[model samples]
Target: MTTNILFCGDASMTDGVLIATLSLMKQTRHPLHIFILTATLTVNGHHYRPFAAGTAERMTKLMQTQNSAHQLTRIDITDLFVADLPRANMKTMFTPYCMLRLFSDLVPELPDRVLYLDTDVVCRRPFDTFYNQSMAGVDIAGVLDHYGKWWFHHRLAWFDYLNSGVLLMSLAHIREDGLLVRCRQLVRHRWLFMPDQSALNIKAKFKRILPRKYNEQHQLKPDTVFQHFTTFFRFWPYFRIVTVKPWQIQAVHQQLGLHEYDDLLKDYRQLAPKLKEVS
Candidate 1:
């Protein structure tokens, strides 16, 4: 059978997500198809092609010397969505809010449903239980907000904070519906941080299916294998500017190795070698 899993990340991002994803492909019990949706260039001019695709292939190759990327498929955004990514997202591009919007736009016209993942996630165990569940009755399976209602609606709803880390949903509902259109309108209106999220929260209002250990945003237990790195940038030096706490990233980085953090720091021009190169 065909199970569609969606992930969004760029080349400049740390190789941790890349490693996590590859490892998951190796462990998944199904046919293990992966669809990566990422643009070729960053708004800053960094190239995503050689690094993202090349590393993915290298990792996959290393995992199974006899295997190809069959268990893994990459949806090159460079081949599809170019930088014309709506002009309104100028300020919020990397925010959690923007990731949701970009992910919504990347849904392809496919027969199978999609399990959208943030690049920061890794599967510690076979997630067949979560994957095979019925999403037909709900828009997605995600976390219920313990913090409070969607930040935008908190003043009005007084509910939980519904985080959008990992989601299993159908493309049909997003495409042939009013959600995507509303996202476009909100972006055009310059609503900023919550454009796509606003639409998603509104559409799936009170309908999120809290999966069993599926949306675990924190550390995983002994039985838990699939881990979604929800806190990659919480401690980001830019945290003061962005204001969101980074979580679960330090631990995940241990298995991914130094090269990942090495490059990520370089991407930010915070590394000495990278700085010397630029100078």
Candidate 2:
């Protein structure tokens, strides 16, 4: 069933978020209208530089491979780069947040009630039910914030900040309220506080917050649909995350058949095997 659209941004390079977004897209039960754009910048008045055209192409290939289930195709939605959005440019640091800010501003072109998900989130269920809701009255719907550190809480105007990593955004409010500007103000001030999450807090003071189950990822998740891999997301979700931190260079080196901790060589060797087998 073709349902309300759910959009997320993508970069030229396929980072952890792109991989996670594709994984979650595969898990969507109904036919999904997912939008993927890049937050590229215009260096000068004449030059156009995207986050990574090659990387975006690679991400397209990866998404196309799952065509049987998700069947997503790459398309260029806009030429607006990260720098053109005026005060909303704070989103460049936390890429996904900026992408959503773009979505909010451009909701007139988007489906009525769509879910704007971040790349770090993994889906455990079909997101159809979340789409068919009426967000006209409700402002925003996202997971409850997960305080990464003690100092994180103090940075916000209030303690209740929803996680923007995964959430349902209402296209109508995005165009009307002009919340993105306020949210960007927070981001520009390094009110970057919790990165993108802090910007959502700035919006949440006036915008409504979604329940916690949508992006649940801490401890035991009995009723969560997605898991936001914050700083503590060191292990794979479904895979039995072995007693190893994925960031551990030694562990990564051994897995990639690397002779040493060579950043350039390790990335190629590590990801090459996985892509080869899958391809």
Candidate 3:
């Protein structure tokens, strides 16, 4: 059986998306049918940049050379729900790309189930571990958001708020129950800071919760299957905190001893040029 995987990102995030894709393909045991959600800058002043030409072709060539079953498909459904996106409580860190997962229903030919992952995560274990596991009867399966759990539990009174970074979606269930529509309604009516994630959590509060190892963050563990570089903020080993990403220039590297990850990104840096800016 083919494992359907989904990812969302834009020009600025090209590096993360490529690294994440290559890393996953390196570990997945099953054949992969990958779907990429993207957007163009529709509104004046809207910041989204279109995917570089030949992006999908390059990805497919890279994956197919390794395994014929690896396929890459890119779809842009920005116009489907662009107006429905929330604004009042939207977080500055979020862009239209963050809301792409909400429009999964409109993606014409998605499989019955698809695993959605943030571009920031790198795969270290066979994806079958996640794909093979049953979703039971839930619309979504995801790891609890350790970063936002307390706020969700205390403020929102939700017991099962999930990290949207790594999720297994039951597309059939989502369509059958009109879950995405309900999620959109929740986004419009509720006070949400992380709009898409909060809407999913509040609408599907009973979603299946996976083990922490599935979406492990920052530090790696022996059993961690996915190393999620979820945070861009780097705290000093002893004192101060700074913001840095592994792919950025060394001017931001902290002495916090995370060079191991920076070096990992360097190994895949050769592929970065494929995502060059439109300018």
Candidate 4:
């Protein structure tokens, strides 16, 4: 069966996306139907570049090399973005690209069920078990945020706040319940710490909490399937936030003290240079 995956980011996310793709390909031999959502926007005079067509073409070729049925499609949603602009949170620390996944329901090309992955995550094991899990009545399935679950509970004291980074979305259910529509409305009017993520937690009615292995945000464990390089808080030396992505090779080795993806990084180093020349 073809595994459908979705990613949303701007042009700057190319390196991370490439590295994430390589790591995922290494884990699974199934045909991957990858979709990247991007848009060119000018908010407050700062320009956001969309993924280049040439870059998409190059990535497509790379995927085909793994499996002939594997495909990468870049979809620009500039018009849709302008229609439902996140006015309240556009200027926040998070980039406008972070909100693109909110528009996925409106995009006709997306499959009914798709696994949405943040560009910063690296797949360490096959995800077919998680991807193929039944989503009969659930609008979305995700792992609880390592930090947000403790603080961002909406109504009940029990933590249900999920990280938006790795979401197994049931687009059909979302469309039926108008979950994305409500999320967009919430983000447009109210500004939250993490707008898109918070909106999802607040609006999604039926959500399934998966095991931490699906989105291991902290230190990698033996059972971790997707190692998410999310931000961490360090309070010992000085109060600071640490952010590390898979593409940052040196940081992965020295800062994180993790050498799990060294072979992948070596391959990335050899292949990444070609992305610049693609266009």
The C-alpha RMSD of each candidate to the native structure, in angstroms, is 7.3, 8.2, 3.1, 1.2
Model 3: pairs clashing at backbone N, Cα or C within 3 Å: none
lDDT per residue (tens digit) for residues 102-179 in model 4: 999999999999999999999999889999999999999999999989888875757899998999999999999999
**Tens digit per residue, CA lDDT, model 1, 1-279:** 545676666554435445455556555645556665555554555334423555555544543543443455445545333433445664565532244334454445433477776656555667777777765646556765423243445335455445665777655655555455565555554655554555566555324546437655554556654555453323454452122111234443553332333333333233222211121
- lDDT of each candidate versus the true structure: 0.51, 0.51, 0.73, 0.91
Residue 76 C-alpha lDDT in model 2: 50
Candidate 2 whole-model C-alpha lDDT, 0 to 1: 0.51
Clashing pairs in 4: none
Runs in model 4 deviating more than 4 A are: 237-239, 277-279
TM-score rank order: 4, 3, 1, 2
lDDT of 3: 0.73
**Would you estimate the TM-scores of all the predictions?**
0.66, 0.61, 0.86, 0.97
TM-score of 2: 0.61
Candidate 3 lDDT by residue in tens digits, 1-279: 888889886767777777787777778767888888887754436666755547777878878878998898888766765667654434445675777788887677788899898877778777686777877678999888876775576333555668988999999888888888887777656666787887788777347888888997656687888877665444455554443444563642453355545645665777667545436
Best by lDDT: 4
Q: Per-residue lDDT for 114 in model 1?
A: 72
Cα-lDDT of candidate 1: 0.51
Candidate 1 matches the true fold with a TM-score of: 0.66
List candidate 3 segments past 4 Å from native: 42-44, 87-91, 154-159, 189-191, 232-246, 249-256, 259-266, 274-279
Clashes by residue pair, model 2: 12-52, 12-55, 12-56
Cα displacement (Å) at residue 265, model 3: 2.9
Better of 1 and 4 by TM-score: 4
